[model samples]
Target: MDHLINHPGILTAFSVIIFIMLLLDLGVFNKKSHVVSNREALIWSVVWISLAMGFSGVIYYFMGLEQFTQFQSAYWIEKALSVDNLFVFILVFGFFNVPKEHHHKVLFWGIIGALVFRAIFIFTGVELINMTYLPEMDLFGHAARINVVLSIFGIFLIVAGIKSWFAEDGDDGDKDFTKSPGARLVHRFFKVSKNYDGDKFFTIENGIKMATPLLVVVAVIEFTDLIFAVDSIPAIFAIAPDDPFILYTSNIFAILGLRALYFLLANFMYMFSRLKYGLAVILSFIGVKMLISPFFHISSPVSLLIVGGILILSVAASLLFPVKE
Candidate 1:
């Protein structure tokens, strides 16, 4: 809270940047439904990453290396976990047989939902952490305060990581997305047409207003992001449980770039075939950090180094041992 209050300028800058970029993205570049080309996706990806990096530089200047590293660590962690979301996005679009041109619109609305839900989760989670700290006690010859919520989240992440590591490929590829809770929620509220009406989320059929598949797809995507947040949100809490500003800013930046990433890598997914392993390791490592925080502290720079190294190696390994189609 104090971190947020003290950094009003940075916050304003972040807000302005996001607002302008979103306006340019939706109002100018993507005003119409169209398939996003690889080249355009690449440029957007670089732009978003550079923006995130530049923001971290500002943090370094104003808040010191610690906050900068925290931002970097959280940004990359959210970015990495977001790859899993891309896989799910591919699945959702494919299942619905959604047109490539419509993908951007769905993802755009999905990210808008993420910006809201992530703020809620990060801010609420921080408040929960602030309230759940147990009385100070000696542990292994040192005094410490254990956070109950974080400990639970730690155990959950460890289990999630182990499940991810051993999980079979295409686990979601065969599922029925129409049965998705998001889809169900949309269905519960409105009558969904069997087909899409261009990229519009609603249309008139039989002289009655009805929802389109695009809207259902967007709903499913929103729900999907919320589910992924369970793992990612808790994972980042290990980095800066006390600072929602660092967590939320880094998170939103990572998420706002995802639509581009999805298009850029959708065809070249073999390049990230080994990424699940890296994500599993990162999740487990953060989980361990949370569990051991009461007794030992790991600095942000070290965590950043470990995470960056793992991501690099994972990409290298993926290229070297590419998945055979």
Candidate 2:
């Protein structure tokens, strides 16, 4: 893993491939503002999943079974976490009354921002973990000294999971973007249009540049992604704390498919009523695993199976025992 991360070529190649794919997605495949059909969303969903698995196959061939399993575990964790993001996205778009045709545009830019921010979060987190090498502080009652940063992340995740598990879904009417710090900051710095201008983020009016509501939507989505990344970045670190290559590549791939996944499942989100519980359980499991990692090392394969099983059972339960209208 250290060797892979130290190799600049591998990192550069992956980054370039991701950029090219994004360009093609935005520049070629989706050049117009139109509602993405359910069929199109479904097709793209399969394509993205196939592409991710294909990359996993490459990892298996080049990095062997262990790293491949690590990548799979991180991918599943990030993908599952992304489902929670989609629920918020639905709320944001509905709140703003963003046109259906413009959803793709907002998501496309939101994902681009996510990639940049996630990289920053990963590098910073890894560095912080590395800096906690204090030989003087022999803590945690274990043979190896406990990493304070990792411990903090584990506790945060466990607490967050518990809170999410018990938190009731709030009414959408209660959400007020104007009150959000991010929204307030954006509004203070830029002049925004009263309405959307056909998916455009900016337009010139009276010799001054003004942002459209679409820009505000993108800003809110980006801020929301940053919040989600706080949870997600640490979860991946728990899976593969030492391997930034696996951590980053898996995160990017999961995010790459998120736009398609959102559209594919948005209408059907109600059917998966138990997904939040599954995510809560997964987060708590990983948190506990991180906390006890000195005493117990969960294999990546086992982690993958446990996570996959939780997701499956949650979906099955949702469908079998749906809330009555």
Candidate 3:
């Protein structure tokens, strides 16, 4: 913590490194925007996700499993939450009639926005916690307590889950979904082009067509994740709250793979209708846990096990009970 804080320049350097790497990813690896074939998407997806997990091994070897446990829990949880985001993406994409060819571009920009948000949230969260000098994480002047903020997050997810469960279920369970604040605000503040003209986000209707409905989908994708920060950030703070480096780096990398994950799983998304219910349970459970965590002594490792177990079982169950049947 002290080393990272003292050498704050490392964070900037890290961002620059990520940028250069992204340049390489797009420029060398995927210069021409080809339809992300399953084989290609899978390869890149595996490479990135494996790298993230490998980083977790590094954390475990150095800081211990408790810390590694926290990262795994956060990474898995965020990945799952992003699944919900995908449900929304499918909706927004369908609504806008975005072309398959242009989908990658939209996702690319949307992911860039997510990276920016994570950087800010993790940095500010750590700085604020440090400044407080609260022996533990005390909001005001007391020991860290799961105050109303946490309860609200818990209840909000519960309600969101129930709403998702019952909301007008479209083909295979893609409901009208938008949990991202940015998406909502943009939808409210700006007028959207209703029809998609090829890959354009905006069209002049007579002659010229701009980026079109595609850009809106991308923006909505970006915004859809705001509420995610609300849930996962606190969840992470629950584990190794002081290590800002772990929190931010793990989150940044996990998200870096999301676009690839999306393309990789795009068509098969319909098979996982049961996943929403599972994620709802997980989110609601975590929210409640975060709310009550202050009262009880739930160790990070235990928290990790419960979360990981839930994810594995949920996946197994979803596969066992397919939506087609």
Residues 178-273 of candidate 1 have per-residue lDDT tens digits of: 999999999999998997899999999999899999999999999999999999999999999999999999999999999999998798899899
**Which stretches of candidate 1 lie above 4 Å from their native place?**
none
Off by over 4 Å in 3: 1-17, 125-148, 155-168, 171-211, 227-235
Which is the better candidate, 1 or 2, if ranked by lDDT? 1
TM-score of 1: 0.98
Residue lDDT tens for model 2, 1-325: 4335755665677778788888889999899888999999998889888878988887787678888888899999999999988888898989889999999999999999998898899988988988874464334555655677888889999998998798786544468865656567678889977877787888888888998888888888999899899888898888888777789898999999999999987878776788888899999988988887765689888899999999999889889987555
Best by TM-score: 1
How do the candidates rank by lDDT, highest first?
1, 2, 3
Tell me the lDDT of candidate 1. Answer: 0.94
Worst lDDT run of 10 residues, candidate 3, spans 1-10
If both were scored by TM-score, which would come out higher, candidate 1 or candidate 3?
Answer: 1
What is the lDDT for 14 in model 2? 75
> For residues 262-291, could you state the per-residue lDDT of candidate 3 as single tens digits?
886686765566777777677666766756
Please report the TM-score between candidate 2 and the true structure.
0.94
